[model samples]
Target chain A: MLAFRKVVEKMEGYVPGEQPQEKGFIKLNTNENPYPPPREVLKALQEKVTPERLALYPPPLSDQLRFKLSEVYGVPPDQIIVGNGSDELLNIIFRAFLGYRSRVAYLYPTYTLYRTLATIQEADYLEIPFQGEDFQQLPSRFLAEEADLKVVCNPNSPTGTFIPMEEIEKLLQSSRCPVVLDEAYVDFAEESALPLLPKYPHLIIVRTLSKSFSLAGLRIGFLFAHSEVVKGLLKLKDSYNVNILSQIAGVAALEGLNQVKENISKIKRTREWFSQALKSLGFQVLPSQANFVFVRSRSYESLEKVYQELKSRKILVRFFPEWKEWLRITIGKDQEMQILLENLKEILGKEWNQGA
Target chain B: MLAFRKVVEKMEGYVPGEQPQEKGFIKLNTNENPYPPPREVLKALQEKVTPERLALYPPPLSDQLRFKLSEVYGVPPDQIIVGNGSDELLNIIFRAFLGYRSRVAYLYPTYTLYRTLATIQEADYLEIPFQGEDFQQLPSRFLAEEADLKVVCNPNSPTGTFIPMEEIEKLLQSSRCPVVLDEAYVDFAEESALPLLPKYPHLIIVRTLSKSFSLAGLRIGFLFAHSEVVKGLLKLKDSYNVNILSQIAGVAALEGLNQVKENISKIKRTREWFSQALKSLGFQVLPSQANFVFVRSRSYESLEKVYQELKSRKILVRFFPEWKEWLRITIGKDQEMQILLENLKEILGKEWNQGA
Candidate 1:
């Protein structure tokens, strides 16, 4: 009786990082900021959500919010599109650009969600392995005209590796296909591809308020691109996709720029300190621009044992089974790092002297 | 430069009802509720939103919220699939069930979105028109095994008519297609088809928190069906489609059922009173079970005058140019309706004296 499509049945869904239900855990697992969003964002959202506003449909397109984003990105309103999240924006890219036979390219371990989206669209997924010492470079051949879409996750997830802007520019030369630079962590990174949107009509940069802005619960993100790409996405999206509250919250975040900057500074400082501490614990911490550190475990056996030990001790951190030898710890509050280090000390305390 | 598929180029997009920005006027253009959602809902939402929760990912599939909806609809966890909104769920249905050439059926003057979705998918649309005096009978003959899907919007939008459950049951008997009953306004109606999920595998009832639950600002809705349909939708949906805020807000709403019921009771009373007032003013209003009243504006001149007069006031209402003679007025608060009535009298002030 169940007639799920053959493609979907065979395909594995993308599993997002675990959101721990257990309380009293140092949840550095999913790279979520330990701090709340700017105070103004919450106040603005609370102030705007008059019970009456919820009765009506939210403004379709959130033109005011879009305009704010356009200002932030230094683009015209026509060149911007907002979504329930950047995930929603990405889905539209798949729907608008890719067809059943269309080929889409992305890195293997970048964001697992990309592959799942392509699979759902039933498009061909071109998994490119990261070869260079820095995982940022892609094959020139991957972005050939034959490929309809290519997604690059910069300040890449799980690994926290980055590609230089010049390397990305080189890949763009051969690509007539639309390039999606998912700069989800760009605010924390050195530069943004958003500034390059005017030069490359086919380039679409996905940005989110989930990370640096610390507003993950209020899902809001935007795609900065050419007018045509944004218009195409609008055609494919729900008329009232962004709810009234998110639009309000998103605009508030934009207006409260100084406050958001202060929060990001706090996270960046915490990230640096946490990274240095992990290195001292006999772990190799990847140079990171994002809010998390990826460390290769000293021993594969200890990695699993340490993960269980951390869980048992009620401190949560991300574990990638594929990268069985690595752990991704989010740059949480300063207090959370202390707890994680304490747990790590207990796990490696006995083995530390013998191994080191 | 503009490279979309032939199907994409041919797609005539879904144009939703007008969302006016201007203030001051008896703006009853769209089917929005006259009054705000319950106070308790807003309060609960306000109380739930803190800085830390906002920093974390919302429970993608909130079991607590889902279970509450389960209690309301009497379905198991596996049987219910919630989404950002019912629109997201509908999109998933099109992708999961229909192919480019697959046939689909829906009412002629139903929610126009259904037709647009079919067009976007490049599927054939079977737009069967309504007939009979009661608006309870449908063209059941349109139900064919070859068609992959069928949608029935109860108390149909624009027309403000409803198809009987018997007619829906007849449509279901064909077994040729998955019948989607979109009960967006089911909260204000007599009954819902959720109970039949146990017996009918292909029957899917799409309900929204937007209507009865009064969480439109929070885009959360659920599809109740046998586990098979849920699986099909899950396969097609973008992972993490529902944001965290919507999930938390939805749980708050369901748990606070007393508030929801009170809002519904008040809205229903307001709707009845407003319908009579419009009739007294020599206007024809459709017997609407939903939150809106669809009425025929007497003359193009008067309709034009009425729309402008309301616009001059700070009220925003929806007006359709497609069928210029008809206006769909949502039930606003009694104070708003009183102002609307007073404005209508002013519009007719000269007309009444002329006795035309």
Candidate 2:
């Protein structure tokens, strides 16, 4: 009865990190900010909700928001393009670049969404596995020389490991194809690929308001690339992909950068504290630059058991079956982290010091 | 320095109907509702604009908005899928259904966006010209036998003419392909293909809040299809295609259905009056089932010249280069219509009465 394209029929859609319906859970499965965005975001919505403003079509290219983003990011307005979310921008990039028999390469177990997008495009993909627990890119072996597009998720998801700027530069300089630095979590990292844009024309860096700006629900994402790359993506994107509310809220969020920086600093502080706490609980935690920490305990089965026990106690942290022993825990507020620690201690009993 | 897909590089992007930046003109070009959406839309935004609400990922599937849509449309919640707009839904449909070398069929000079979508998909398309000025579909020739996907725009754009339900049924019955009835303008039309859903599993009807609901800026559109079709689209769509504010505002808009109906009634009433006035003033007005009238004057050049004259006098209506002799005039408020009439009379002078 179904006549969808072969790829679509065979492929499972990208499953997002679960968002539990109940309110009592310490919701950390998704890497959403524990705090709210700047008051200006809310203020913008309140002031801009007039009948006249909501009646007309939004500026098609989001010119005002782009101009504001330009001022904040120090990139020319033409070099940036925004999307409903970075997901939409990724979809556009895939559509504009990948065709029949196109090859894409990214690190395995990075953002799983890349694999799903490649599958949807029917593109051949090379998932280069990271060398070790550090999730390091084996640049010489694959991405720099092969594939039509190379995706590097700086401060990669789940792992929360940040790849260095020099490594990204080497890939951009050596690669025949365009390289995308998905810096969705880079606001918490040491530096950004945005600084490398002027030197590397083929380098595209994507950032999201979902994390640093605390506007995940508002669905605002932007990419910085050469003007030609931006022009090509504009051709593929839905004209009104980003709505009027997102544009207004995004502008306000940018305008209140000081508030966002404070929130980021708080989250970073919380991340460091949470990592130490997890280590104290007999878990080996990776040094994380993003808002989340990746950890593995003494055994795979025990790690799996801890995830279930935490869920039963109304704590939601991410677990990957493929990784088996590892858990990606988003850093919530200090109180939420304390509750998580208490629950984990209760689940372990006195055996926590026995390292399994 | 550019490396883009051939289809993307060679094709010009879809240019949306001109949204004049400086907005003093009686803006009628895009068929936007002259009235506002329900007061509840604004009220919801004001109440829901908390820090916590805008910080998390939106409900990935938009379950709450879909539930409300289901209640209003009498469709099952499982059968509805909300999009950033119906535009995003169309993009998903194209991606899921079409592949390289796939063929698509649509009416000529319908929503111009469809052809652009087909180009982006790199699919071959057949543009079947409508029979005569009434823009009737030619069912027997090509659509059923040849194309993999069939698109029917009901209460079609520019012309504002609708294909009858029975005609649509006949086409759906005969076609082996999936048929999408884009009902973006259907709220003002006589009948909808919605009732045909149970009978034809391959049929999809797309609707938007942009026109009748006066929520153009908010970008909420949904499709009614078989649950399986929705499942396929869900796989192809970005996880959070619809943002949180649009979801909240859409739910509130649905709650205020009475206000939407009243606005629709006013536009329909104005459409009838305005069509008659144009007819009396030497323009051949097509029978409209939408909020706009498709008109033609004595000569193609004269019609073109009239558009320019109207623009010069701070009035705006859509002019299509391909449909050279025609103008799509959106029905505005009585006062705006009066101004349009006065300006047209002034531009044409006594010559307008002489049919030129």
Candidate 3:
């Protein structure tokens, strides 16, 4: 009586962060930009939603937006392929590379979507655990390219720790299979994998406007890779993968680069200050290159209580059961961060003291 | 140096109909709605582009849209899943069902995307060819449950012939695997396979806003199936597959069903008139239930010449090389169709007659 494939039936699938509809919650759970996109993005969106534009099909390949991204990344147009999101690109990569016989490897506690995608494809999943609390170094065997496809999320989520470019290059050099460098958070960090595209034929760098550009609702992402790799991916991509409104908004975000850069800088500065503030409150905060801070309270028991208390106060932050002691909090505006700190101090003082 | 899988490297990808950017041509190649979408759709788009909405993630799984679609289709909320486009839904289906050992079947000269998708998934393809000019029947063996997944495009594209519900039901009842009824153009046709969902748990109906709702540029599409089928698809879908603007525009389109129905009726009328007009000029035409006419001149050589003449007149209609004698002409507005008729008369008289 069962119609679905064995893999789909067995899989629980990826659960995204809860999107609470209850009003007045400080939403810091997902790593979305707290600030609104630039004014120009709205203007571009205004122009694209007209009757004439909505009636026609979008350009299949998103040529104009890809051209704009090319100039921004200083890459050839052939090397760029736009998708509905980097999420779609990840799906396409799996379809093109991994199969029943093939296997995929990703860092343990990385973007969980890769695992979900592999499960959907029914491919073998190899979890490569990072060393210690810093979660930086990978095992030598994991880097030897045992899997058909390998994914590394730079400035990894939940941990907010970035792997250095030198380490990535070393892995790419030794790896026999293609490597995907997911740079979804790289805009907040200093280095990008775009420069390494020409040198490493096997490298595919994925980026998104959901974070740095503050347009998560628009769903735009791009892949920077060698032309040959891009060609294979293009074959697997859905025609008209990117919607017209997203393309317009993406271009507008690119045009207003200075404004977006200012916002990123503000988030980074706030992240640093927020990290120091969390440390002062007797919490262990990981050094983050992304827009979010990953922190753990003084004790493991305190973590669950603090998260619940924060939720009761309508301040939402991400708590993963696997990482029981840790919490991933996105950097919001200064005012939001201030309220968070004040709330944290009150919650920690009352709850931790009572528990002790 | 070759990094892609064997299937990816060996297969020729799907090439969508040409999107001509040159102005003033009677742009009918891709079957896009010639008239603009309803005013309400634009209004919805305008409302959704706000800075605040753009900064956050769209409702994962598009809950609001599915609710609206539920009321319209008289199906429960769980039975519908929205996608970036039906194209994306197609991709998800391949990932969920088809695999290395699985096989897919689709009618020849139908929507070519199905074959391309199966190729991308590395699934074996069984292309069921229609007998003659009117592609009305599928081979009996194709109906037998040989393939893991079967696709039938109702009001079949390129040929524009509609199969009755009885045929669909018979196939569904006999199908050993899941059957996907792609009703991308079903709004223009008289009947759909929607009512069969309750009777056949294996039936999955895919519809798109690209054709009837005239929101192709927005990239909104939906799947109507049994709740169990929808559940399997939900697990495979990207968390935030549909963008905010598309969801808003889709809800608005649903709200403005009257306007969309009026547009569909008008296109149906134009299609009738245009089919007669083509027949008057000694051309062969299949009975079309969709928004376009599938036509071929009396002589095969004359068909290619007429296509070139139409292009010379800056009236672009789709000409599939594989279907060398045939041309798929999207029915535009009355005036546009009239202009197309006059131009066709002139081109057929001059170039096609001269070649004959």
- In candidate 1 the C-alpha lDDT for residue A44 amounts to 88
* CAPRI band for model 3: medium
Q: For candidate 1, what is the recovered fraction of reference interface contacts?
A: 0.64
Residues A1-356 of candidate 2 have per-residue lDDT tens digits of 65899989989888887877678889988899998899898898888768876778888888889999999889999999988899988888888888888989988778888988888888988988777767755547764557789898889887898778777777877797888888999999889888788988888889899998889998999999999889888988887778888999999999999988999999999988888988898889988899898888764454777888889888999987768778899988999999999988787774543555
Ranked by DockQ from best down, the candidates are: 2, 3, 1
Q: Largest lDDT belongs to which candidate?
A: 2
* Position B152, candidate 1: lDDT: 86
C-alpha-based local distance difference test score of model 1: 0.77
Candidates' RMSD to native: 3.4, 2.1, 1.9
lDDT of 3 by residue, B130-162 (tens): 766567766687787488899999989988899
Candidate order by TM-score, decreasing, is 2, 3, 1
Task: Point out the worst 10-residue segment of candidate 1 chain B by lDDT.
Answer: B297-306
**What are the per-residue Cα lDDT tens digits for candidate 1 across B1-356?**
54665566667567776676655445466666655565666777788778888788877677678988888767788888889888988888887776667778887767878877887777789877777644667765665535778888887887666766776777788755678899998878777776676778888889888877767667787888888667667866665677766777777777777877887888889889998998998888888888887776464433644665667775555566655666777876788888888877787775642432
Worst 10 residues of 2 chain B by lDDT: B347-356
Best by TM-score: 2
- RMSD of candidate 2 to the truth, in angstroms, is 2.1
Name the regions of candidate 3 deviating beyond 4 angstroms. Answer: A352-356, B131-133, B351-356
Model 1 residue runs over 4 Å out of place are A143-145, A301-305, A348-356, B273-284, B297-325, B334-356
Chain B TM-score by candidate, in order shown: 0.90, 0.96, 0.96
